[model samples]
Target chain A: MINSRDILETIRMIQDENLDIRTITMGISLLDCCCDDIDRSCQKIYDKITTKAARLVAVGNEIEKEYGVPIINKRIAVTPIAMLLASSGGDPVKYALTLERAAREVGVNFIGGYSALVQKGFAPGDEQLIRSIPEALAKTQHVCSSVNIGSTKTGINMDAVAMMGDIVKEAAELTKDDNCIGAAKLVVFCNAPEDNPFMAGAFHGPGEPECVINVGVSGPGVVRSALKKIPDGNLTDVADVIKKTAFKITRLGQLIASEASRRLDVPFGIVDLSLAPTPAVGDSVAHILEEIGLETCGAHGTTAALALLNDAVKKGGTMASSHVGGLSGAFIPVSEDAGMIDAAREGILKIEKLEAMTAVCSVGLDMIVVPGSTTSEVISAIIADEAAIGMVNSKTTAVRLIPAIGKDVGDELNFGGLLGAGPVMSINTASPAKMIARGGRIPAPLQSLKN
Target chain B: MRAVITVIGRDVVGILAEVSGKCSELNVNIAEVTQSVLQDMFCMIMLVDMDKCSIPLADFSDIMKKLGEKHGLSIHVMHGDVFDSMYHV
Candidate 1:
């Protein structure tokens, strides 16, 4: 029994509030596509994805019209190419190239699963894929790469964690044009959710259905507005007010996703109820913190405060939707979250503090801005540090640091709205590049080997 | 005597206020109530002390049934002991 007004407001959210089916990610397992011959496997991989995903865009568009909801991104996630390569004898770079070609042909914005789960440790093809990440991602526009270097169960695999520090630099150097956008597509995770439909973390799990639809709902603006209206500022009231507002917002997501799935004839994935902050002015996790009485975001009690916010959002969101997944927590991208930008400008938040906060949320250190002159090796070290956090905790984490050219510490570079602005944050003078520059695929963690 | 009322449908205008108003007129004291919207559909459960009510259970339940059907909702009336045994206890 939907109300006409609630229906109208839902429609308005789609038409204006940047609300869209964040991703219509089709997960295709490549197990059936595998063969001893590499080319045959590639052909099977290509055919399976393109054929299965052919109706993806049309279906998304139809739903947008019928329900007046917008579906923004259409994507595909294949079984890890590394595993496919184990039986199909081919060069890693060439295999990645085939994946990129298939993605372009399928017309999906991004195709994930150029990944390896090294949490416990890497398997056979993991080495080849990790080694070829820079070349593979650089060679193809549609391919997104992610590596799960740590998980809560196995703890952080420091050796593999050590190597990824350098891989990021190579990736950034390869895609220099999109403001080091290659690094933007890479994610490092702890307990990476198997059903995450968002890229660059999306990958078809061995256990997933061949094709499915998942909706990642983000509305930091809604939360911010609620926070802004609290006239009297008590920390207890702030938390209570946020909890109630989040309950309503998450309910909206659950309804929209359930309705969308019913109409599209696809099983609705999780209502990712993540408070994913954008560069939009009021729609930031950091801003919410500031509104909760922080003069600046990265102040002394920042991590504790953020942890509370992150946990509360999850608690309320889970109650709203049973099928919740995909980094269902607040996102604190430094460059993309406005509150983060101000904190960096005020010299309160730093890379180290953001790393500290990831222990409680899904996405790790994100949207940070480092000095452009900083070497890629150090950037890799940052990736490594963040990766370790994800691995030890078994949570999905990522790094989206921007190396703004000609900008030094304390200098602010604004990406403008939903990708807000970030101050050029200083890096540790004691560099890790020399250590990261060592280019071998670090041996798979010993714990990964089993009977 | 007691009666449990349940409303199952989508949330809309005046459902709670109007239904509660009827209960007030009948002198039925609401002991407990809770509601939630599940995937666009609303479900509510309410317990009332019908012993204090002026109207008979049949009359009060009749009013709820008429109002609910008018607004495209389904209404259910149950005895207090049955309602408590099934839901409360």
Candidate 2:
């Protein structure tokens, strides 16, 4: 028996509080598509993706209407292209073009997996693909790329970290006129997840199934609204509220994931328990932090609030869904999140503070726009800092810094839509050139160390 | 298949009759209906068996949406599983 209270609450969450499935990302394995010839590999890649995800968008729309819940994006994630490049041994850009075409053909908003995992060291095709990211991203419209340079068990790969600095800059420079959109699509990461359903960092890991459906859920507004109702609640009460709200949100994702999997006949993957925020007014993770007794998002107690929120979200979400993976926590992307945008523009949210928040939050240094004059070495140093956090803490952290080509601090770079806009925040200009130049692996930390 | 159709708006004449008429036209059998009038605002929840509906589920949703707009009410026809999955587990 369905109760009216639950039905009304669900409706309110969807209608007024901005509850929605962030994405239904179909993960397609391209291991079988690898070929010695580049063109043949590209052809196989395109055919496999188009065929597997042919009805993804249509099904997403049907589910959205039938369930009265909004499905924001129907996207795809594929096995890292570097493995295909390893066998094909040709222009990595060809794979990017092929992915863009497949995304267009299948009518998906984005296609992720132009990626390489050299967390410990460069593989056969890793370095080449990393170098071609700038050009590949500049040419393609819907393809997203990510590179993992470090992991907790293996430590940081300094060589790939240095190379990614140049790649990130080139990606920004190549698409300078288009709002540095290329940089927005490229992510440099430590401990990257292969099954992430989010854009700019999602890639189907080699271990994933031939084809699977992963759902990412979002609802910062719902959480905030719940918190607002209990204004006098203690810290424990805050955590409880978040847990209850997250349970409802994740259950929705689990339902959608299983249904989509049943219809598509693809194995259901994880339901990422992330509070992915949009540029919309109520849908901001930063605002949720403020609601949890903070003066502002980047204030003194910001990190502690974020930690509680992230932990409670996972605690609640884990019980709701059968399996949960991806970067399953509160995402604090500065540009894409409305509260972070306001705090950032007002200088309350500093890059250093964002770095600190990332230590406790899900992702790191995401959607931040810095001055174009910022050097590759500085970017590398930032990535190194983020990688260190992930390395020492045994968590996933990534850097997606967009260099506003001709814009200075206080200037805005607007990408429009879900990519949102950001004011060019200040960054440390001190030269880390020597540190970045001395490229060698940073050895792994002891796993059992306390305090 | 079962769906929960909820209509919320200012209290007006023939609200239930019109909604039932649309459902009957589409061969959707309503098993249970609960209506309330709170402070002059009308609220109704209808649990309908959608298996015998003539149109596809999505199309039926579209028709309900258009009908709601025409009558200036907020109408939502969502699958029962949404409420079940969320409220049960």
Structural similarity to truth (TM-score) of each candidate: 0.73, 0.98
| RMSD (CA, Å), each prediction | 11.2, 1.5
Chain A TM-score from candidate 2: 0.99
In candidate 1, how many Å is residue A359 off?
2.4
* Residue-level error in angstroms, candidate 2, position A254: 0.2
lDDT over C-alpha atoms for residue A26 of model 2 = 96
Give the clashing pairs for model 2.
none
Give each candidate's interface RMSD in Å.
16.7, 0.6
Candidate 1 lDDT over A1-451, as tens digits, reads 2232333333334334444445667677888988898888888887887787777766666544433344567788877787887777677777677778878886778889888777666687787788788788778877888887666556655556666756776676676664566666677676677778777788877777766666676766666666777858676777776676566566655655665566556677777777776665556777777767778888878888888888778776677676887778887777777677777777888777877888776688776767777776677677667766665454677776666655678666654434456777888868876666664443334444543
Scored against the native two-chain complex, candidate 1 gets a DockQ of: 0.02
lDDT, model 2: 0.94
The segments of candidate 2 whose C-alpha lies over 4 angstroms from its true place after superposition are A448-451
Q: Cα deviation of A26 in candidate 2 (Å)?
A: 0.5
